[model samples]
Every structure is written in structure tokens, then in C-alpha cells.
Target: MNGQMELVSARTVKGPDPVPDLAAVDRLVISNSGGKDSIAAMDEAVNLADEAGVRDRIVVLHIDLGRTPGGQSVEWPGTADLARRQAAYYGLPFEVRRLGKWPSLFHRIRARGQFPHLMTRFCTSEKRAAAHRFITEQVNALGVSGRPARIVHVMGFRAQESRARARRPALEVDHRASSGRRTVTQWYPVLRWSEAEVWQRIRDRGLPYHWAYDAGMSRLSCSLCVLASVPDLTCAAGLRPELAREYADLEEEMGVPFRRELSMAEVIRRAGDGA
Candidate 1:
């Protein structure tokens, strides 16, 4: 427990944002990714909806972003399969959407030879927010209560992930809210939960999770996220040979050079070198 931290109740400690009544939300979109945080968020969403008697109005938003920087398994089959499993387990309806094209532009940028330092979070806008936008539009099109509009979109962003997120208000208007658009209310139920508490909730609620985490992949960003540490990259590259090779090929094709100047294979080799 030395480095471990738990998520405390942000709502009880700080008063709730009253723009939208917690119980009056017409729709509660559980932005599920089949990851630990998403799983925990989904469970919390369901519980909250039921407690508020809006259980029948809750649904799952699953997006398949064609091809990740690593591979397409997650997009073609993995994400879909996991979403199905989660939906069936929760006895809820899941709306699955596959984006029109590959994240070609984003991948091209990430593979453009420059490491994505915090300033150019091209991946966030391209991949993460892109998916969020798609789901929000879908919900708005589907309408809240009577006419289409954004209701409450709950996500699984942990404060421990970043300092900025750690400072986010418990319930805030979706920053992505645009002028003339029905504002999307954002909620963070597991915002205060720790990684261990998230998993425990999954166990307690019997929620399903992606195999990548158990396979030693942490924080299920795109398989080729720039945020990966050398050790994590080595772990993934070794565990997935073809994936590593594909990334190697991508590095060459994109004409971008990764850190250490050595190939991913070399990185993996160095990982086991001292061990």
C-alpha cells in the first residue's frame, strides 16, 4: 500500500453539480472499453441508474477504432467480443460502432518520428476524444427523454493517470460542449477509486475485463500508445511478436525513429538481459 492510493468520494466531500439532477438524467452512457476502469465505471453507472430508478434507460457505448497503432485485433474482434460479453453480463443493450476509416491520420502523426510529449497529445484528440465524440453524437441523435441531446456520459478516467485529471472536478460540464449543442454532463463515479478498488469492484460485481491487462498490459491505451515506458513496451513487444514486428514495420514505413535508436526487438532483448 506504499504507492497505492484509493479513490475517495468526490461528491460527498464536494457538493454535486446541480445543472442536471443525478436521478433525472434521461440517459446514462457508460463509455466502456472493456478495461478495468471502464468495467468499474460501467458497474457504478448501472448501480447509480438503478438506485435512481433509471436502470432501464442505461446503455453501453462501445467504439471500434478500425486499427490501433499496434494491430487490428482489438478493433476487428477483440473490442466487439469484449463489449458483447460485458453487455450480456450486465443484461444491458450495447451500441457498437466502427469508425469509417482507420485512425490513419493519427497513426501517421504518432509514427511521424516525434515522441508525443504532453503538449502534442495528438492521440487523445484523434483516438480517445474521437471515440467520445462519436458516442455523444449517437446519444444526441437518439435523444434524451423526448428530443435528441446529450445526457450524462460517464467515463473511467482515474486521477492517478495524470496530474491534470487529478485536479478535475467530480462532476463538470463536458469540456467538449460546443455552442448551440445540448451540453453533455460528465460524471466520474470511480474517479475516487484506486486501481485495487477498481479490480475489487469488478470481482464483487463479477464484471468482465480485457485480457490485455492480465497479460501485463497496463492502462489499455492504443496498443502503440506513446505513453508506454521502455519496460512496458518490451513486455508487449515480446508477448506479441507479430505486433512488435508490425510496429517495427510501421516505424520504417512511417519514417519515424523511436527512442534508444534500437528496434523494439532490441528493447525486449535488453529487458531480459539483466534479469
Candidate 2:
């Protein structure tokens, strides 16, 4: 853990920001997405919390985006339950918070007549808003004395995911969540971990992960995330044709394609053709 150490051989190494003093935090909230990266992040965070003797402050939080109109899940099936199971494995308290105004993400998209784009990602914004609300509630419930409550919000973003994610520091102050009443810190415990290391960590802990990976998905998030790769979109459409058709229906109604580069119908066709 030397700052000047060049640990090139290690799959997981410390990132730019030094690890925070966990014992000083009032609450440690791990955002669970039921994805492999998230699981890996949770494992690291839990271990650090245990070492700091603040395991009691750790809590897992899951943001439940509602299902499609026809009851099909917007996310991978069983994701929320798996997140709960993960939290249970650590003997940590878990809480689920849903979108307030919108019943489902599909409903929100249809109402707006636009699918979330890479540059304009309302879906992520909404989810973050929900998480923020939940964090705020926790801050309020804890009751502020003379000082701001310290809250560490743990997320699972890996350097290997994308250039944007790669550029992120391991820990930074979350100004959006911070106020006079509370100071929020965004912590990416596994930010420097590799995909292989993530899997190894999960295997070592003997924790169950979302089954979507075994079903051929490399990553897990929304079943048909706008930011997903073509192959992933095709695979998701093939596994969940009914939901794919629903998305196509939305596209047809709005007179817009799912992506400017391609349509949901086209993705469905690719899936059907086994492309």
C-alpha cells in the first residue's frame, strides 16, 4: 500500500485517491446492482469495513427500477433478489428504493418519446436521483449533531469498463449528496480491479451472482441498456422476445428507432437469426 509502489503484477491495486478512514464515516452504503463488478466491489468494501471495525455501519442499497407494462423486467430477471441475497451473505442490512413518480422506466421513456442516449442518459440520472433521495433519508434519520454526517457511497465501476470510468478516481467527494447536514463521499473500492480478479474474488467468497452471465451476458445492467453493445442487445432480445417486442412497439409508436444507428426491430431480427 505504498504510494510510490509500482505494483504492475497485481490484478487489483489501489487507485489514485487513498482509501478513506472507514471508522470516521457515520454510514457506509454499498450500491448493489447484482452485477459481477458490483459484487466484487461489495466484497472489497465489506473487507475494509471489517478491518476498520465499522462493519455495523455498512448497509447495502438496491434501486428497483419497475418492470415493463406487461410485467417483464426492465433489468435482468431476479437481479434485485440476487442483490438482497448478496447483502445477506455479508450479514448486512439491505434496503430497496424505487422511483417515486414513475412506475416503470419503460413508462418514462414512452412518455418522453425518446430512448436514453449515450450523451443524454435520463435513465441513469433517474436512478442516481433515487439513490440520492435514499441517502438523504438516511442522513436525516441518523440525526445531525454539531457536525455533518459522513456518508460513503460505494459503487462498482471498473477501470476496464470504459475510458470515462477509467479516468475516475477511487474516491471523491460527492457534492450532490453533500450538504451542511452531511458529507457524502463516492468510493469505488474495486476501481482498479480486473475482470478476472472480480470473478476470482466472487469465487473465493462463495457468493452467488446473477445468472445472466451464464446465459451468455458479459455484463449485467438493464436487460436492454441503450449503452449496451450490439451483441448484448441481440442476446437480450433473443432471451426476452416479449420484452423486445414491447420495446419495438414503443419505437413504432414514437416513430423513432431505439438507436439512431439501429432499431429495436433490427436487433430482434438479429437475435432471431442467431447473429
Candidate 3:
């Protein structure tokens, strides 16, 4: 399904030739997910800001999903740490935020009696909302200080990643209002970048990426995301048998499978088929 990009008008003061002043922008927030695309996106954002002479206004933000019931991260190990290190490498401020206690994917599943499926991707909703909340708070704080708080939110979504993403515009004025004194805009710096270009950028910087990519995983988000490809699911299940078992148990308890066709146990079994 293709997602339509939302259209919103930029707020401007009335004048003979009223134009939104880009120089009045206060912050550029980059959503860093510790994935290859996110890393590339950050690099592109920094480069663009540098060209526009606004590099100093850039900040990197990451959201921690917290640990599961078994005290393990739902994301790949060291994902957050990698993001912090990358921020340091880029000489930018880094902030980590979460939705407070019980923020784990498993907690949500237990509460809903089901996992996040393709149709109802509660996981993405929760995480995205948390990031938005953080941005809103920052805007409000700047407003209280009587500053022009214009935020440019940079995301790593690429057009080539999916049909839905391909429909997104390179830039859009966010519909949601922040503080009255603040304006928020969304930008996709690398919206049209290819996967090869993404990896090339990472290598050009000599950066160490998340280990999951090295382990042959294509996309990096939730370790057992419902949108995971068969190979990704198999590899995740193989690498983290304990986590796979936990998911399997949850599936049994809910009397519903996370994947449409295969169970977690079946995915694991297939993972070891060739070996």
C-alpha cells in the first residue's frame, strides 16, 4: 500500500514579499535508528547542513525500546551504543529517549494479547509517538525561552525501500503544530538514494555499523519484526534461540501466530535445514 505524503502550509508573517526565513531555524533533529539507512541519512543531513551553513544546529536523537522480560533488548545488541558512538564521531549532541517503563515490544504484545502485525503495526506507532513527544517537548522549551524554534526533522526513509516510501516527498511541512512559537518540517535527505549508495557512504566514513548487518540481516529494526523477510527471521531465530522460544511461547499463549504462514518454531527449524 502506498502512503500519501501530507501537505501543510508553512506559517509566515504577512509582508510585501513574505517568505519563510531559513536563517531563523533553531534546530535540525536527525532520527538515528542505528541502521544503515539511518546512518546514511545522518551523513546526508550533515553534509546538507554544512553546505547551507547550519551544521552547528544539528542534533542526533535515538529512542531506546528498553529491555524485554528476559532482560534482553528487542533490538540488536549495541544498537544504541553504536548510535551514541556515531554521534560522537560526527561531533553532534546525542539524546536517548524512551516511553518509560514497560516499553518493551514483548510488554505491548502481552498487553494486547498479540504481536504487531503488518496491518496493526503498534510497535512503529509507539516508537514514532515517543520521538514526536520528545520533539514537541524540545519545541515547547525553546518557545518558553522566547526563541524562534523551527525544527527540521530528518528521517532515514528511502523511496527505494518500499512502494509506500516511494510516494513520500523530499520535504513536507508537518501537519501537527508544535509550540505556538515553533514550526516543524520533515525532510528526507536521502529519499532517492539506492541501497548501494547507503553502504558506500558507511564505508567512506570507515564507520562500524550494527553487527546484525554483518550477520547478514538486511533491515535492522525489531529483532523479530513482523515485516522481517524469511531469511531475516530465520537468521534471527538461529542467532537468538532463547528469544525465539519466548516469541513462540507468546504465540501459543495467544493462540495466534505472529507470521501469517509459519510459526517461530517452524522458522527456526527451517533455518537449520541446510546445515
**Number of clashes recorded per candidate:** 4, 0, 0
Q: Please give the range of 10 consecutive residues that has the lowest summed lDDT in model 1.
A: 1-10
Q: Over 4 Å off in model 3, which ranges?
A: 1-22, 144-148, 177-181
The segments of candidate 2 whose C-alpha lies over 4 angstroms from its true place after superposition are 1-17
Q: If scored against the real structure, what TM-score would every candidate get?
A: 0.78, 0.94, 0.87
Top-scoring candidate (lDDT): 2
Q: List the residue pairs that clash in candidate 3.
A: none
Task: Please provide, for model 3 over 1-275, each residue's C-alpha lDDT reduced to its tens digit, 9 standing for 90 to 100.
Answer: 10111222243221221222334457788999899889888887786567668778788999888777788788888989999998888899999988644668788888888778778988888877787888887776665464446777888888887788888766666656454565677777678878998899899988668998888899998788788888999888888777888888888989988777878878878777832
The digit string of per-residue lDDT tens for model 2 on 12-129 reads 3364456667767788899999999999989988987898799999889999889889999898889999999999999999999988799989999998889999888999989999
In model 3, the Cα lDDT at residue 130 comes to: 80
lDDT of 1 by residue, 124-157 (tens): 5555555566655665666544323546777888
Q: Residue 55: error of model 3 in Å?
A: 2.4
Model 2: lowest-lDDT 10 consecutive positions: 2-11
Q: Which stretches of candidate 1 lie over 4 Å from their true place?
A: 1-20, 68-77, 103-117, 132-136, 143-150, 259-265, 271-275
How high is the CA lDDT of each candidate model?
0.62, 0.87, 0.76
lDDT of 1 at 135: 56
Whose TM-score is higher: candidate 1's or candidate 3's?
A: 3
